[model samples]
Target: MVSLIRAIRDHTDEISCCAFSQSALVTGSADKTLRVYSTADFKEFPFSPLTGHGYGVHRCCFSSCGSYLLSCSTDGSIIVWSSETGELLSAVEHPGRSPLRVCALAPDSCLLLAGACDGTVALWDFPSKTLRRCAAASEASIVACSFSPCSQVFVTGCTHGDLKLWDDHISLLLAQKDAHDLGVTCCSFAPHFKIEDSCVELRLASCGQDSLLKIWIVSQREGTAWTMMLLHILTGQTAPVLSCAFSADGELVVSGSVDKSVTVYDANLGTLLHILKQHDRYVTAVALSPAFGLMATGSMDRSVNVWKIGDGYEETEAESQQAPCQGRKLPGHSRLLLADWTEEDVQSWLCEEGLDELVMIFKTNNIDGSEVNHMSKETVAELGIESVGLRGRLLRKIEALKAEQSGSEAPDEFLCPITRELMKDPVIAADGYSYERESIESWIRGKNKTSPMTNLPLRTTLLTPNRSLKMAITRWKSSQ
Candidate 1:
């Protein structure tokens, strides 16, 4: 992807908006200042700070034609400004909470939408600069709001998992089915679709601490009401979903997460397409370039990453040269009964099975002589095994037989303690440790093996790849 890490003037506070236009990039900051940087040279333009908002500016957006700019602030004022000059055209005030969460300028009209923490969406006419309309939700802090392309309709999600839709005349309740167990953090409409004559198919995407990305299709009915249907539910991250945006084409939706990855999903299939994994902190915001097919992501890591997505997909060094089967495998267990066996395909398995964890043990020939000697000595020391983990004369005899099979470099050694083999395929184990089959066998083969008979509890694996091993361990500990 085209990298655009231009070093512009840095803000001491959080940057709430990076409004990009053909001529300039306007950024609103909590530092109570708006900086206009030239898009060509990444140089800051000299302008006086617009000083109306009593608190920090929270959101800023430019009109589609790039002729006007709109800013919402904690100062309870929504200010309209001219892009050419730094002149403040007008400031509209409301009696709600401070620091609006989102400010949206209509795509094809001279209308502006601002959502505040008081569950209110206030609409204003930019040309007349007057409060044209207002709508109140069910008494929950509004977290996000957006206007449709034609500026005929707008949507807002609140702190109470409620989704409210509004037009110029009346407030319409769209879908408020507990959209998130937690408060809704962000909401946006598809960027590609047009709001035209017949019927406009609007896709509403919402994310929150509930760790789910819900896609809904809201169709404007013949009358004043609209119907909403749940299109898809995406569950892949454990951390809170921070922000989401539709690609210009509307075929793809990119979501940022506290899980520290920007996940791109096919808006059609709702399947994950790619994971951008360079961020080292919680990703709070994301924007897709309209002209360059580039992605800009901002995070708590205090750095922004600009990546090219399509043909420019790049792989990390480890991923590029990784062997197809670099990990090791374990032999099937003989002493223990079938830990897991598949009678039917995975999907046919009952949902009640959920995911289970299993530990397995196997025997294998040692690769190097020194390595075998070290392992054997350690096993004997830790387990008090005459050979590996057995004691007494009969066990000694069994050890001698095992030794006979083992060459100078451990030829055929029975994996000790008869731990349940970490099966790679989903199977029911003698112990109830069940989960999606992973390379636990591979991990065991290369490490100091632990005793299968030990009272150590089975660890539960997280269902998402975005979760770290630390999270897995913590979850496991908490469950115990």
Candidate 2:
């Protein structure tokens, strides 16, 4: 259930690239300008439209810490900016006056990598603001580039559809492969995984004009060399795939294509889950924010769409209801303490304590506090408690009554009508029923203009924010 939060319309031309920081978003455009917008309020910066590039800006990115921004353009220059104030810090001229189409920042924020139309990759050290290495990665133009999470290695995709791996510190080619039949558009390294005591598994995802997405497994070989093996070839997009990104947890892969659609896939299962067709034109970029369960897509139609994603549970009502469970008993002491307590008694306690919102949540979810003892602290936090102090107090109380219980289940109302998982940002639609914002939006805009739960035609697609419900959900989470 992914939906659009807002569609910014400032850029005169198509938005080529977009990057999100801790509190702000930076976007580059073919209009030859870069704009900074506050994530808090989605307001453009006062001194925005950073205008130093002589040509269209192709790519923009934020450093790992979100303290700096790097933007590259067709003018053959990369400009670094202070993310806090949107001030120009420095500019590095690209070699051979080639359009720098792709760029990457190391995880440590110590190095910057840029790939240009001249088929060369340039590495620069941030501290000294000097070029450290520049080498030709391909005879064709470099289209996409990404650094491994560890920052020790990087991968570059060229117009000829060649994928090349390189050592970060020095310009050294480690491995090369012909990945696609047509030009490669984007490439990204998956989060690292520890497979064995001495073995680590790394994966690379690349999408290209061939309308296919490929995953490659990179692993350390016997001594000092690394080996790459094709892991999977995902084919569903009708048009060329332009951009791809791995979810923060690395369990999901999302790609945008020229076919005016976005596809979400199960990374581990290698299966298609959803094909979201919201954009009217080519979807050029897609980004996932695991921390907030958000997905954003930028398109050539001059719009940016933000979607709400669930925790990989897109089951139908029947499937979720049929999910298996393992039963376990509560601790003896805990059972004795709650022997005389009832749902009404818990509601009374909440009322007396001025926790009216939490009482509403309990009532809505059909929770009696009896199941609170079964939830772990982490699970409670996921309920969306906004007050840290209140969460801590609830955690201590739950710890006193908790034991190893396996048959815990969430309330049916907590699940979204579309995703069948607990709603992260629920909203009341025209049907007068609560649904996850993204889920409902996807339904009304992408699918049928009817309610999934009621299967009734919606008079209007308008939705109202369920603030009180959200507060109650937060309280419920704290209790869990």
Candidate 3:
């Protein structure tokens, strides 16, 4: 279970976007000011409320090392800020100076990308602040973008509902059309990849105006060609899904919706874990800290809420055995994801929903949760539902079910091997497992000097920052 830690109501206008560095959080607003906060205490970072954009700010991001923070604005510029000092480092303008809608930094800290409302993409050399390529990527507005784990290719999603892959040079590699109906609001790539015999596979999470969150399997084979396959389609929010992100390890996914809700899910099983409702208006942005177990959600209500999602690890026996729905259990098939229910489950659901009269008809037609999700007015008529009012009522219920997640692991890397708690600051000792920095430091100070996991003499009393694990903890702390 997750709990809200705080709700920060500082921005005076609607929050357009928010992002997390390993140690800090930054939010951009329609008020044209960007505020920064220390992850250590959630207090305003020194020199915060950066006033650089001439117009509304849309999006922001931090480099992998948290050295630089970037923000794009309707002012048609992407400004770079020194992460440590909040000083303006550089300003790069989008081609044609059209209002910039989105921006992303490659994980390598080598490249910067900015998407303009004019349907063009500007790729810049981050280290030098020089424009590398400017090209047209879509006919509709480019609103979402992310670099692949390899940093050789990037993906961009537009308001036209198309997702495209481009090489670092901004050359088109592949394109998937209508990946989302209506339009795409956000897309994110997991931080790491898996190696198979000949292909490197990665996971991607994308949400859109269709009010659905989708997972994609993107792989590269032969080191030349690429393929993208749909992995799962998650419907967990009632309104347009405005933002989404993959946990650093890519095990869990989170999304924010215009329905003023935040939803978390098991990335692998696509099971609903929890639905949190606290924002008074649309949740416009969501971010998770890498190793800090922090999640921040920004909303149109001018508030940003922080949460503590357990480090992404598999659940314990007790947690896994807990009832799916707390307080009261679902009567039957309602406990399953709508697409996984069987015929018997559907029959039980109908009976529990006070539609027992339709059980025989549904059973006769082999209708289940999957079938229910595909129901339209025509499909209902085909089911021999004669009453218009009853048919309409069933459709409404089906729609409502789509937005609910029932409940759902943490990866071990985020836990301190000594304290067995989610590490606030993770560090890697010679033992090969990450542990809380304070716990390890204390162990080194003791006489034993033994590895916590191995009970062997420590190779050395030194610990290095587990930067990757920290990124994992930050990716899914969600709000409301």
Candidate 4:
């Protein structure tokens, strides 16, 4: 019915990247410090911090075993750290000006691949402390990349609208395709979690500034042969999708966007199950916790948010766990791809005390005909003093506040375009663009208004309606 995990408060400045380990989460930010928070309590530790990057971190990942962490910065340096103590173990510099955006670790953990700003993929070997191989894929900046769980095969996408698969040697190209016309910001591999009708298959999903999510299938044939097919396409996100990821079971997918929301999709059918609005700004990153039930995300708003995903929303052990891997909870949630919600309505209710932190809980039945909930012990514990209280009393109060104020929504009071803060007045943008505060108020409560002061629902109003803005408004009005 509601999300148990909420943002208590932000401790960092513009969190750029985040990684989840069993013990804690390590966040790298524009502040140039890596902050680790205990997953057990969502509590801040003594703060074992790492410093050195002159710019914000771009990407970060932990070894499959969770022993070592890797972080790449806009400064062109990749730093390896000990996950346990937050100690910097090694730093390698890429020979380019742009940041390293994507990374992958081989199954053996001995080899690592870093995708850089110059549209090149560089390989590194651990303990050897040497660069192994480097290969160029595109002329544009590389924004997204990932490795197939099965083989040495990996894929990378660039800002110039290209996607290519590569061999383990990082040399020969396995396949290449222009997946999108706009800059591809995120790409991910679908897990082979279900064996219901296996015929040597894999899936890849990519999203970009084009506002589309396309699914591709990788099929195998005789003698290392492969075929990629476009299976399904999802179009609804208002802005560019920032991240896309698969659920543990490969049955579901999730994505985040510049539009400030996260959407969950059924990986196989491409059904949009949930659209969550929890962040005040663009959602920069999203990751499924190892437990398969919990999900975590980071945003430019400088906060880390966690969500519990399961029940009617996910496949349970009874429905999924059978025979060979029955007891083994598939390494992830079933058929789910983690890709990365609604606003408070203010017209009907007097005030919404904590409407911004609300989350929806989906309880799905499994193959075994049993129900499961993804809310973890840590997630329930993170519930605020008012939420996880006696007999859900505090929850009742919070719900009461949301319900009373939700139906009476107002837009202008909902958010300030400039600071991404709550708007306070009948404010006019500096460029002379002004909106009727009542239009915002009505839209927030799910009311449709014909003459909204703000023409673009997905974008902030430009202070000046220049030629470009005029063209955008024209196109928007035409579409409407």
Task: Sort every candidate by TM-score, greatest first.
Answer: 3, 4, 2, 1
Report the candidate with higher TM-score, 1 versus 2: 2
| Tens-digit lDDT string for candidate 1 (313-421) | 2443322222121111111111111223222211111111111110111112211222222344445354333343332432343344345434232111111112122
Better of 2 and 3 by lDDT: 3
Q: How many steric clashes does model 4 contain?
A: 54
Number of colliding residue pairs in model 2: 0
Q: What does candidate 2 score in Cα RMSD to the true structure?
A: 18.7
What tens digits encode model 3's per-residue C-alpha lDDT throughout 1-480? 675655577775678899888889999887788999887667898799898886678899999999899999866799999989999989999767766789999989889998876688999998898899999999778889999888888999998899998999999988999999788999999888988888888899999999999999998887678889998999988899999997776778999999989999999999989898767689999998887667788887778877768744233332332222222212342224778877766665564455657778997998877888788988999989898888888777777666543331234455565544567898888877788898777656544355644444578888899888787787744411
- TM-scores of the candidates in the order shown: 0.60, 0.63, 0.65, 0.64
- The TM-score leader among the candidates is 3
Please give the range of 10 consecutive residues that has the lowest summed lDDT in model 1: 354-363
lDDT of 2 by residue, 335-438 (tens): 23443445654554344333445656666665565656455668667667678876776666555434322223345466564444567798999888898898
Worst 10 contiguous positions by lDDT, candidate 2 = 325-334
Q: Note the Cα lDDT for every prediction shown.
A: 0.57, 0.73, 0.80, 0.60
lDDT of 3 at 306: 74
Higher-TM-score candidate of 2 and 3: 3
Candidate 3 off by > 4 Å: 311-480
